[model samples]
Target: MVQVMRALRVSRFGGPEVIKMRQIECPVPQVGEVLVRVRAAALNPADWKLSAGLFQSPMITLPFTPGFDVAGVVEEIGPNVTGFQRGQAVIGWTRRGSFAEYTVVPAGVLAVAPANASFGEAATIPTGASTAWQGLFDNGNLQAGQRVLVQGAAGGVGQFAVRLAKWKDAYVIGTASTSNVELVRALGADEVIDYTATRIEDAVHDVDLVFDTVGDATLASSVQAVKRGGTLVTIAGMPSEEKVQEHGINVKSFGVVVTSDLLQNFSQMVDDGALRLLVGATFHLEDASRAYELCQGGHGRGRIVFTVSK
Candidate 1:
């Protein structure tokens, strides 16, 4: 008999109400893939966004699991795969099906789990940290000693951005609500603006770069916070060409691209005590719909994760 595992599946685009927990066949690893018995998984905005029918793509099909960040033990490895073995602890980013007892991960995105973190903590690193890394360094071209302002500093990606910017010796300023001001400061932000108390443009200006994790009108107004020759990078939404021309500064946007090398570097950082993953809340696999509700409501202080197994 084929092995089966419990999975959170979505057959339609809607809200948390559409999510259904069901048992599905355990996937076999294909070439260059590894079968992971998922111990934990982190939730991202992309998970809910994808579930709501946004970013519709040809690759997505109905009745598929929705999750990206994963931390687990390698249960099996496919042909031609090397450098990993059965029962090794690992973390990876998958396109889909991470909210399950078992998932098949593309080998290119897999990495050894950090020795210092629990599986739940490790699960929070992939999507948020990688997005922060790519946004600040790859797209924004942040430099040491420069002033960088991060909107939504207490969020999953925002907190990582603040810490990583500080790691690079940049002066980091962050915006958060009153409750998160001290939280942002504890993450190494040089300055923290309470967005609830003051407007961002008035509170921050002349920064070398503005990293906008909050998009919409917030992203549109971020141009005002950056210096004339500065850059603005957002993961939420891209500003239009008109805004770019009017602002006269470089503006870019990107989604996270998980790589083995990046994940390994993150693991080393965790082991060396240079980085941390903050999990705001956690739930069992059966409570995934409620987890989605919390995340979608946008009230969590950090990443929300699902603990599949101990």
Candidate 2:
């Protein structure tokens, strides 16, 4: 018999109102795929952006399930897969969508869950942390003892950027609103600027890297914060190319790439106590509408996750 499962499907591009929960057939794993029984699914701003017509992609089909990060157990493995076994706790960046009881994950992106973290905690790491990792080390080439300025320091990716820079022995400066000033500081930031009180460019100078998670005007001003030959890496938006040229600095933009190797490295960090994982809020899978609403409105700290099962 074909198994039926509940999923939060985005039937149309709109607000949270467009997300509809319905019973859908469980997807079967194909070659190089694994069927996971989802224990938790983490929500990203991208999810809401896609639903609300703020982001457009040719790959997004209508009536799609609305998540990427998931923590679960392998229910079955498909042909050509190896290393993963049934009933093993795992986490994945399921491009197939995770807002369902089960999601089919590309085997290359699945990793065993971190022993030290819960499902909710594990689910948050793939997207936000990887973006931070790629932006800082891969793009910015950040070095220890150098200074980093992170705009939107209290946000999900910003929180990880602060800690990762600190872990790399870099001095970290972060900009957040008043509510998140202490929060960012607590995450090993050497300094926290309240964005409401001071301009980032006015407060800091010659930073080794400016990692911008907030775009628009702040991204423009961050060019002045970097030292000559330093780097600016943004996951938010691009700076004006001509303006960047005059500053003698390098600017790069990237989207996070999730893979089993990356996930495993993070898992090791969790077990070694060098990294901390967090979730701002959790909802039942059936309450996905509320989850979408909260994520769309913006979260103050950590990732919002859906607890799909025990």
Candidate 3:
């Protein structure tokens, strides 16, 4: 008899209410693929945005499972797969289907989970951490001794940017609500600005790099904080190229790209105790709708996870 597993599926895009947990046939891995028995999955803003029909990309089709990050155990390996074995703990990014109890992901994207991190903690790394890393290093080209400012520093990507920039020897400044000021500091930010109180432009100036997680006005304000030749990297919205050219500064926006190398580096940081995972809350797979609602609620200090097992 074939076994089946439960997955959260959205037949139509709309609100959090569209997500429904249902039983589906478990998939078997194909060549160069591994079937993961998902232990945990992390909720991200992209999950809700995609669910709400905000971000439409050719890579994501309708009537799909809506998770990008997963941490679990490999249950099966497909033909020609190497460097991975059944029953090994792993983490990776999935195009879709991670919201299910089992997902078939490319073996190349899989990496051994950090020994010191829980499955829930490891689940939070792929999308947000990779975005923070790529945005800071790849797009912003932030260097040591430079002053950096991170908007939404209490958020998943923002918090990781703070720590990663600090690890690279940058002087980090961050913006968050007054409630999370200390949390931002603990993440290695040298200065924490309360966006509710002081204006971001007024509090920070001569920044070599600005990592903007909040789009719209916040991204616009970031341009003024960086020096004339500095860079502004946005993960939120694309800025006007004309506006950037006028400022004599570099401006770029990025979408997170996942690969085996990126996942491995993230795992190494966690293993070496250079990075910390912040799991704000967990929901059972059955409560994935609630998880989406919570993520959309918009004040979470860290990643919200969905547990598929245990």
Candidates' lDDT values, in order? 0.89, 0.89, 0.88
Error of 2 at 93 (Å): 0.6
Model 1 worst lDDT run, 10 consecutive residues = 238-247
Compute the lDDT of residue 282 as modeled in candidate 3. 91
Tens digits of per-residue lDDT for model 2 on 69-176?
A: 999999999999999999999989987889999999999999999999999998988888888999899998989999999998888788889989999999999998
Compose the digit string of candidate 1's lDDT tens values, residues 119-184. 999999998899999999999999999999998998889989998999999999998889889999
The estimated TM-scores of all candidates read: 0.97, 0.97, 0.96
lDDT of 2 at 204: 95
Candidates by TM-score, descending order: 1, 2, 3
What's the best-to-worst order under lDDT? 1, 2, 3
Mind giving the per-residue lDDT tens digits that candidate 3 earns over 1-310?
2289899998899988999988888888888898999999999998898889987789768788878899999899889999988889999998757988899889878898888899999998998889999999999898999999999999989989999999999999999998889899988899999999999878888899999998888977798888899999998886677778777888888778888889989899999999999988899978887888889987778789988885
Query: How many clashing pairs in candidate 2?
Result: 0
Worst 10 residues of 3 by lDDT: 238-247
Superposed Cα RMSD, model 3:
1.5
What's the lDDT of the predicted structure labeled candidate 2?
0.89
